[model samples]
Target: MTSIDPQAKFRTGAVDMTHGGGGRAMAVLIEDLFHRHLKNTILDQGHDAAVLEMPPGRLVMSTDAHVISPLFFPGGDIGSLSVHGTLNDLAMAGARPVSLTASFILEEGFPLADLERIVISMARAAREAGVPVVSGDTKVVEKGKGDGVFITTTGVGVLPEGVSISPAAAKPGQAVLLSGTIGDHGVAILSKRENLTFETEIQSDSAALHGLVGSMVDAVPGISVLRDPTRGGLATALNEIAHASKVGVMLDEGEIPVRPDVEGVCELLGLDPLYVANEGKLICICEASDADRLLEIMKAHPLGQNAAKIGEIVEDTDCMVVMKTGFGGSRVVDWLSGEQLPRIC
Candidate 1:
């Protein structure tokens, strides 16, 4: 028998089918490995699932999976990505994320050391977001039957009374606000994967933005909608909101913030920065008067330091997102038929 170090073999023990079977191996792994990293009262209940107590408010829920290739990237890794993705989903719904459930699929022949690093990163992310992984499950597949590891996370939050937000609520004349710079996450991944050199280093904007979301909501109670521009980036997010609310958008090309390095990368690769992925950015649509307050609150936070009002909603017969170029021309921004950057989130 291979000696089990017994100290939560996060860095050594390879997961086997026995870890998934409801036997001593499962219990031991859960106790010494999973619970060891994700510590919380509800998790201590020791049941198959976590029983949570909800606050006095409406419930908001969301789920997401993390499968970013290379696992580790410039500023973050897959583990933290899992937590951030689900939390962002709940946050965009104007909810206070209370807890999360994690499910892991591990592949045979993968080193346990990498697993621990990922789990630790996730724990750190959840802690920073002030949420917990209250319950979770793990499974192992035969070699080549799975990627090294894939994590699916579900988050539940509570929305305060009178806090109604949705894409359908967006109105013409409402203002559009962006949380921060764009395309950092996509450029960071591409640089690492392709070994491209850049004058200034690019880092992934992978982070949990629930705190920023809370502040924005508090600043403006009547904020119409909030959407994080991720996989399809700002263009797709805005187009969706336009279609949802039956409004047209005229974006100020000069107003949108794009890092110079990201711009250079796009110029070199013929990619549009507006369509790149972002992990820590959000797009807020709100009444005209509330735009300044919302932007003020977003700018006050570290995650939204570069916040700006990029455009405004307009009344039009056709729901379209048209951008006013810097040089004086208009172009329609449409949804991407297929992903421009695959496996990004």
Candidate 2:
């Protein structure tokens, strides 16, 4: 057994092959960095696999791999983003997240300072979400073969009885609600990547939605669908739900919210805000009769204060997503053909 010095600080030096060789260096790295910040009862067990006591309900599991560029962005970094992304996935299923497991792929010669920063951020995000990372693995790749670091997080949650939501559950006459303004996350990343500046700095809307989701489910258990518009943005998310439910989506372009600065950046770059990414937003689908009540509940939460009714589900065998323009014309909101704003999550 390799003895680790708990008092060791990685203020300098870079990660090397020895850190991932399963030796004393690896032990010191895990103890002084990862475990130091992310310590919890479950993780402290030091078992290869965590033994969990699951609550009574259906188990919900989601895995997300984050490879965002410019690891650090205006509002969040890879660490926080990884935690938020996976938790939001569980939240979209109307589940209460219980635990998370993180796996890291580090490149040789990566700075220990940056790694420590990311670990601290991840720990803070997990603590704020009331979720613990119970187990994880780490590996190092050749310097040229890997990016600085890639984080893959797997989240496990519990779905309460009598609450079910899915993309396929959307039906005709369902109201489509948006949690907040779109395009913030993508635009923020683009600005940072391209070295562009605007009148006001656009910050990524990265956040965990489980709290808002819990309240919404408690208020309206009949919600048909809940999805976060991430990489492909609102257009792709709605199209996906439309195809899954075999329904058509009719959206009022004017009803959707977009920040003025975000719109300006997209326009300058010849990109459409509708297809830009968002991290802290969600699309909620429910019966038209329950729309008002659900919207009220959403508006009451901090994460959903900007919620709005942007569209509705209609009967259509073709399963298309169409938007009514402000000019009184309608157009098909097609799936994003190729990657727009790559490495945006």
Candidate 3:
């Protein structure tokens, strides 16, 4: 039997079914590509599983799969989105992410160069967030059976004592806060979609929010709800929280932040910015008394510089999300009926 070359250059090479055969090809791909970029002490152990000491606190775990179209976008790609999305899930639960595990499904004939670029980007994002990818698996599919690549990431974190945050904790009379502008991510992906062009490039707001979430938890331990509006955007996320807490949301349209460019793009495409997705923004539901303080804390963080108090929880049997229009009319902000932008992480 011939052994795969560990030192073989992959610049012009493409993934093949043998890479996922759990043989020499698979070993070389894991050790040379995945390990070469994401290697850590635990991962270096090369065991089938990673073992670690658990911190003295409650644990939080979240997983996400990334299948965004146009692997590369203005400010991010599926790679970074996979890391940020998973970490943000843990952050929303008031957890300090400790580690991540990634899984990749690569299509045969997919360019090795592109795969390496995505891996490098994922590694960079994890490093910037102070979380390491401790374990991962790779598989190759038939040439036409899979998209270029799909990444699945699972993240784990520890929650501090006395910090309890959940959608069910929301109560009437609580204030709602937004970490930053909306629609940036959705529009960014739309702009970069094949044959879709806009006057200016709109970058995805994809980022790891655990740092900002940590600061908020420190400043206001009693925060009721912390949610990042991702796929369904602000409207759908708010609706979910409302239903969970059996409350209503009253939003001031004028207070919600939307970039002028993003607004224009939404209007041009006949899309509602409220329904558009955002990768880096969060929705905070807290006691009305702490709203001002939480807003201040959020604004101080780089990721929360555009933080604004956009709404408040209210009593409503219907558990609806209502937005006061700029023109003095009120409208219901309903759950997104269908995918506004498919394949958006």
lDDT of each: 0.88, 0.94, 0.91
Candidate 1 stretches with Cα past 4 Å from truth are: 1-3
**Model 3 ranges with Cα > 4 A deviation:** 1-8
The list of candidate 2 runs beyond 4 A from truth reads: 1-9
lDDT of 2 by residue, 1-345 (tens): 545333444676788988899998897888778888999999999998999899999999999999999999999999999999999999999999999999999999998888999999999999999999999999999899889999999999999999989999999998999999999999999999999987788999999999999998998988999999998999999999999999999999999999999999999999999899999999999989888988898898998988999999999999999999999999999999988989896
Judge candidate 3 against the unseen true structure and give its global Cα lDDT, from 0 to 1. Answer: 0.91
lDDT of 1 at 219: 74
Would you list the rank order by TM-score, best first?
2, 3, 1
Model 2's alpha-carbon lDDT is 0.94
Question: Is candidate 1 or 2 superior in lDDT?
Answer: 2
Candidate of highest lDDT: 2
Backbone clashes per model, in order?
0, 0, 0
What's each prediction's TM-score? Answer: 0.96, 0.97, 0.97
